[model samples]
Target: MSKPLRVGVAGLGVVGASLARLLQRQSEALASRTGRAIVVTAVSARDRARDRGLDLNGVAFFDDPRALAGSESIDVFVELMGGADGPAYDSVKAALNSGKPVVTANKALIAKHGLELARLAEEKGLAFAFESSVAGGVPIIKTLREGLAGNSIRRIYGILNGTCNYILSKMETDGLSFEECLKEAQRLGYAEADPTFDVGGFDTAHKLAILASLAFGTAIDAEAIHVEGIETITQDDLAAADELGFRIKLLGVAERTARGVEQRVHPTMVAKSTAIAQVMGVLNAVTIDADAVGELTLVGPGAGGDATASAVAADIVDIARGVAIQPFGRPAHMLEEVERIPMQRHEGGYYVRLMVVDRPGAMAAIATRMGERKISLESIMQKGGARLARRRTDPPPAEGAPETVRVVLITHATSEQAIREALDLALADGVVTQKPQVIRIERE
Candidate 1:
C-alpha cells in the first residue's frame, strides 16, 4: 500500500464540503488512479459546530484557516475560501510560503494576485494550481495552457457567469422583465441576494483575467479589462434581438488585436444559430480560436457543488501524481507586458434601441447624428411603442399627438466611442425620450 496523500481544505461551504465528501467516498478509486491514497487529514471553516453531513472521524479541525495551511497534518493545502483578500489571501500566502502545494478555486484572488503567488510557488519549487477558478467544471485552463500549447491562440471568450446567464436565459425564453427574472434567480439560489458581483460582470471579468493570462502568456490584468453589466437589458431587447436573428448573452471576450490585447465583458448579441447563443439557463460555454485548433468550444454546467468540487479534486489528483504544470503555462516571470486595449476603441456591430417622439423629421435627426459619426446602418425598424413604453416617464406622449415610436437600429462595425458620441448627439438633440439601450453584436 502506498503512503496516503494528506489533504487539508479551508472553507467548507457548498464546494468545500462536496470536495471533502468526494475524497472520502472515492478514496479507493482515487488511490488506484494516482497510485496513492488521497486522504482528508484536516479541515477548517467558520462554524465548527455546523454539521456538513460529512463524517469527520479522526480528521483534525482548525478554527483559523491560516493555521490549517501550515499544519503538519497535511501535505497539500486546498483553498476553497473565496474573496480577493482577508482570510483566503492570508491562508493561501501562508501555505505557499511554507513550501506546500496549493489547489484553489478562488478566481478573484487569482485575477488580482495570481502573478505574485505563482512566482512565490515557483521560487520554492512547489505547485500552485487553480483549475476551478474559471468555468466551474470545464477543463478550460488545461485546454488553453496544455492542450492548445502547439497553437497560437487568437481569441477566447465565453458565457462565464452562470447567474447572469440564467437571468438572461429566463428573460429570453419566458419573456420576463429583468427585475422579475432576477428575483426568480435569487429564489432558486442561482444568484446571491446582493447579485451585483455576478450580474454586474465582475465575476466574469475575474475569470477572463485568469484566462487571458494563460491564453496570451501575459501578466494578469483584471482591472484593465472593460466591464459592462446586463442590468440595463430588458425583455424588449430580447424581443428585438429575436426579430434581428440574434440572441443576447453577457460575454467576456479576450483577443489579440493589432493594437494589443483586448478584453471586455458586456452583453453581446450573438447570431441565433451560433453555439453560444444556443446555450441557456445556468450552463456555460467557452470558445477558443487558435491557429491549430481553429475554433473549439467546450460547454457544461459552469457552477454547482459537485461540478466545481470535481474540478478541485482533479487538481489534487494531479498534484498527488507528482504532475506539476506552470501556473499560467509559461513561466510567470517570462510573461510579457501587453498594452490593454481600450473599450472605446473596440470595433464591433451594435444594436441600439431608442424611443423617440413621433414628430416630423425625428427619424432624419437620428440618421443624421449616426451619419456624422460615419456609422453605417445594417438595418433599421420602427415599431409600436412598448407596453411599459415610457421608461423616461415623458408625460404619457401628450394625449392627442402621435404616440412615442420605438426604433431599433443595427449598425455596421464601428468604434464604441463613435457610437456613444452619435447617441449623445441624438439624446442631446431631445429626440430620444430617455437613455437609449445599446448591446454589442458578436458575429461568431
Candidate 2:
C-alpha cells in the first residue's frame, strides 16, 4: 500500500471534533476503499486545555490555524472554522498556497469567496472541497458539481436554514407568534441570543449564492441576491395563507431567466400540497430542475456537529480516493459572468392585507386603484367582524363615521410595478387605514 494521507484539522469546534472522531472510527474502511490510510496529524482551536473528550495524544496541536495549514506533516487541510473571513480565510489561503488539498464546511467563506478560491485552487491544481457548505449533510453540492454535470439547471430552491424554518414551523403548527417562537428557539438552543444572521435570511442567502454559482456555472455573488426575512409574518398571515391552500416558508430560490438570474431569499407562499411546503421543523430540503435529470428533491438534517462532519468526512474520503474535479463543476476560468436580474422585474402573485375604513366607497376606491394598475384580484376576504358581533361592544359607527375592516386580497400573477402603483394610489386616496402589507407568492 502507498503512504497514508496525513490530514491537519483546524478549529476543533463541534464540526471539527466530530470530523476527527469520524476519521478515527472510519479510517479502516476508508483505507480499504481508497487503498490509502487517512490520519489526522495535527489539530488547532482557540483553547488547547478544553476537554473535547477526543483523544488528541497522537495528534499535534497548534495555537494558530495558519501554522496547521503550513505544517509539512499534513497533505490535506480540513477547515471547520465558522467564519467568512479572519483566521478561516487566512488559513485556507495558506493551505492552498502550500499546495495542500482543502476541505471546509464554512458556507459563509465559500459563498463570499468561492469564485476566488476556486480560481486559486484550479490554478494550483488542488482539490477545493466544501461539500458541507451548502445544505449541510445533503450532498447537494456533489450532486450539482458532478452528478448533474451533463445537464443545464434551470432553477434551484430550498429551505436552507433550520433555525428560521423551525421557528416558522412552530408558529404555524402551534399558532405561536414570531417573538414567542424565537424565544422558545433561543431557550432550546436552536437559535442564538442575537439570531439576526439566521432569522434575517442572511444565512440562507449565503448558501443560495453558493448553490447558484454551481447550478449556473457563474461566479459567486452574494451581493446580487435580494433577501427578505420572516420577521413581519404574523400568525394572521400564516392562518390566511393556510386558509388559501398555501404555507409560508423562508425559501432560497435561484432561477435562470432570459432577463438574467433571479436569486432571492424571502418568506414565500408555497402551495400547501407541494413537497417543499411539507418540509417542517429544522429539516432542510433542496429542489433542482435540470434538463436531463428533471426535478430532484433532497431533504435531510441541515446542521449540527455529526451531520455536518459526515459531509466534511465524505469530501476528505473523496480526496483520499483521488477524486479531483472542478470546484464549480467547470474550470474556474470558464465560469460565466451571471447576469443578475432585478427583483422589481420579478413576476409573481401577491397577498395583500389592508386595514380599511368600512365606509361605502372605501372598497370601491381600493378596487379602482388596483384596476387602474391592471392588478386583477383573485380573491378577497373580510375579517374583524367578531368585535361587532359582541353585544357589549361600543356603539356602531355614526352615519358618516367610517367603520374599520380587515380586507385581505390575493392578486393574480402580476408585475411588482403594478402592485407598487396600486399601493401608492390606495395610500394616497386614504382608502387604506394602514400601510398595505404585501407578501409575494411563489407558484410551486
Model 2's TM-score against the true structure: 0.95
Angstrom error of the Cα, residue 45, model 1: value is: 0.9
In candidate 2, list every pair of residues with a backbone clash: none
Give me the displacement of residue 391 in model 2, in angstroms: 16
Please give the CA lDDT of all the candidate structures: 0.91, 0.89
Cα lDDT tens digits for candidate 1, 1-444: 668889999989999999998898898899999999999999999899998899998999999999999887899999998999999899999999987899999999999899999998888888899989999999999999889999999999999999999999999889788899999999999999899999999999999999998999989999889999999998779999999999999999999888789999999999989888889999999999999879999999888889999999999999999988889998889998758787889998999999887788898999999999999999998875544555554466556655678899999999999999999999899888769999999876
Runs with alpha carbons beyond 4 Å of true place in candidate 2: 384-402
Clashes of 1: 0
